[model samples]
Target: MIGQVKKMIKQCFFSQNNIKYVDYKDLDLIKKFLNPHARIMSRKKTAVGARSQRQLAEAIKRARFMGLLPYLSR
Candidate 1:
C-alpha cells in the first residue's frame, strides 16, 4: 500500500532528473523507448508526458539515422 503510493507520487525519469533535452548519442538509453518492432513506445505505456515523448521519439529517429541504433531486430 505505502509502496504503491510512493511509486505513484514519483515523477518520470526526465522530470525527476531535470533533463531538458534527450541526447541522440545515448543509444543505450534511447533503445529502451523502442519496442521489438522498432516502434516508439506510447506515452500511456511508457508513463511519459507528451513533450518528453516527442523528444524521445526524435532522439531515437536521429540515432537510427546515424546508425547508432538498429532500424529493425532479428
Candidate 2:
C-alpha cells in the first residue's frame, strides 16, 4: 500500500515537473495530482514533517523517474 502511494505521488508531481520549489498552497493541487494510493500515504506521512516530506517526495520521484537506480534496470 505504501509503495503504491509513493509511486502515485512520483508519477503526478515528479514526473511532470522539473522545478525544485513548491508552494504550501499548491500542496492541495499536488495532492489531487497523486493517485488514490499516494493520497493515503501522503495523509499518513503528513505528520512526519511539514515541509520535509515535499522535499523528500520530490527527490525520490525525480530519482525514480530518471532511472538512476541501478536495480531499477532489472
What's the distance in Å from true for residue 13, model 1? 2.0
Error of 1 at 55 (Å): 0.8
lDDT of 1 by residue, 1-74 (tens): 77666535535677877878999997777878789988888777777777888899899989889988878886
lDDT of 2: 0.45
- TM-score of each model, in listed order: 0.77, 0.31
lDDT of each: 0.81, 0.45
Residue by residue across 14-37, what tens digits does model 2's lDDT show? 335554565434545445434554
Task: Give the true-structure RMSD of model 1.
Answer: 3.3
